[model samples]
Target: MQYVRLGKTGLNVSPVAFGGIPIQRGTAEDTKAIVDKMEELGMNYIDTARGYTVSEEYLGAALQGRRERFILATKSMVRDCSGMKKEVDVSLEKLRTDYIDLYQIHNIKTADFEQVFGEEGAYKALLEARHEGKIGHIGITAHSIDDLKTILSEHADQIETIMFPFNLVEIQGEAALKEAKAKDIGTIAMKPLAGGNLEDWRLALRFVALSGTCDISIPGMGDVEEVEKNASVCCDLSPLTEEERTEIERLRKELGNQFCRRCGYCAPCTVGIDIPTNFVFANYLRKYGLADWAKDRYASLKVNASDCIQCGVCEERCPYDLPIMDMLKKVEEDFAR
Candidate 1:
């Protein structure tokens, strides 16, 4: 497998890097074994989030002795300076590292632009961290194409990298992603396997590995086998076979409209429900068969899918035209069963 430059960041990363979301369902020892495999296979990019419960801590334990072997990336949702400053410190401690390769403003929305780039905003905190050598680069992750456009057009110089959903079903951000690449902003595909919705793991990994839009695609790997499976795609950087192309088209038609991209655009859901998150937990329950874990997470939410009051406001805001109320009702029914 060959290393690809992460845009102009001077870092060469594996085409199929490690996504840290699924490690929440595993143990620290599991993460250690997975990381060990990754190091052996030269899959050296690790991305995690401060919101992913124990993910950072597990990776911290796993990378304790060999922190220099990989590029460690993590994100936070805090938008204010003092809070983001504290969040960065917390991530560093939890990852057991003094310096992170990339620290991102996680899941940023267009509505957050002014505050995130303004005085006393989280960007200032990141700049401070970079100046202090606590982090190597600053990046932003958005789920919306409009937000991606705004970043490239307005603030491309401020961030070194960008992460958004770019998969067979969610290429809505393609134009913006291309523009980001043109500007030399490192592009990261956050949910390469369509958030666990797509079943053909090998083809899904190959699509993103060969796709020129993103410098790297991060598919979540729960254990060592998953890590190996994803890493194997890097070696087979061959063109998509005709059968794979047909299957990709079939999947796009089947899943293009209904799936939630987890962009969080349908905010202020009248009833305080996180619409995208409800769908996410429902996917974990139904598709991934992570029933107990998904149910536990769903139960923890103050607002569940059942809380939807049938208001169609969210659907109005959704870019993908997802029947959010109907989907929420289904999610409610799924959990009830």
Candidate 2:
């Protein structure tokens, strides 16, 4: 597989890395099989999170004696120093490792900036962990373009990497990602397949590889076949063929309006719903054939799509101007059936 330096951290990683979200649908053995394939293909970066249910634990088990074989990265949502300090240890324990390669402030929003970067904030915990040899570097993940832009422009000095949604349809982060690369902050592309909305895996992977906006693209992988397919593309960093470029424009027109990029601009749901999360669960049910898994996850949510009262507050905030109320209705219907 082809490898690249992860910005200021200077860690060399595969251009196509492993995303841990889909591991929630698989067993420990399944994770090991996938990891074994990754090792065989020389794909060395594995990203998981404390929020992805059993992802970190399963990966820890999968790594076993081979933890050194990969550059392990994971994230947490805790915002305060004390909580982040404890969560880092919990992540270490769950991953069965004394040290984590990279620990990220997970899914930061615009409103979270002050608190996260302030005194007694999670950033302090990460800095301490780095000093204490618990983590090698710090990164941040965001779903909003504006939030990522802010980090790239202002917080660039503090973070080594930034991950945001970048794919065939979600070019909204294009400029921000370019700025990130310019600032030497590693750019990671999440949801390369548009959260499974894009059916063409080869095209999706190729698009991100050729985009030049990201150092790596981590599409969620559950099994060995996926590992092989994603790994194959990394070897040849070729530009898109004429035919491929045409196909991309076609895809852009086809999916531009209806797809939810999960930017989270439409937040603060009037009824206290997690809008992007509801769409995510519904997408898993529709695309991953993980109906039972998706339903169980949706069940755990404090509020589901069914909770949306169609007040249209979320619609007003959406940059895409998605008919969120109508979309939530579909998600509710999908889960209800």
TM-score of each candidate?
A: 0.85, 0.84
lDDT of 1 by residue, 2-54 (tens): 99999878799999999998899889899999999999999999999998899
Worst 10 residues of 1 by lDDT: 256-265
lDDT, candidate 1, equals: 0.90
Which digits, one per residue and each the tens of the lDDT, describe model 2 over residues 265-289? 6778887899988988998888679
CA lDDT, every model vs. true structure: 0.90, 0.90
Worst 10 residues of 2 by lDDT: 256-265
- Deviation (Å) of 206 in candidate 2: 1.1
Best-fitting candidate, measured by TM-score? 1
Model 1 regions lying over 4 Å from their true place: 261-308, 311-321, 330-337
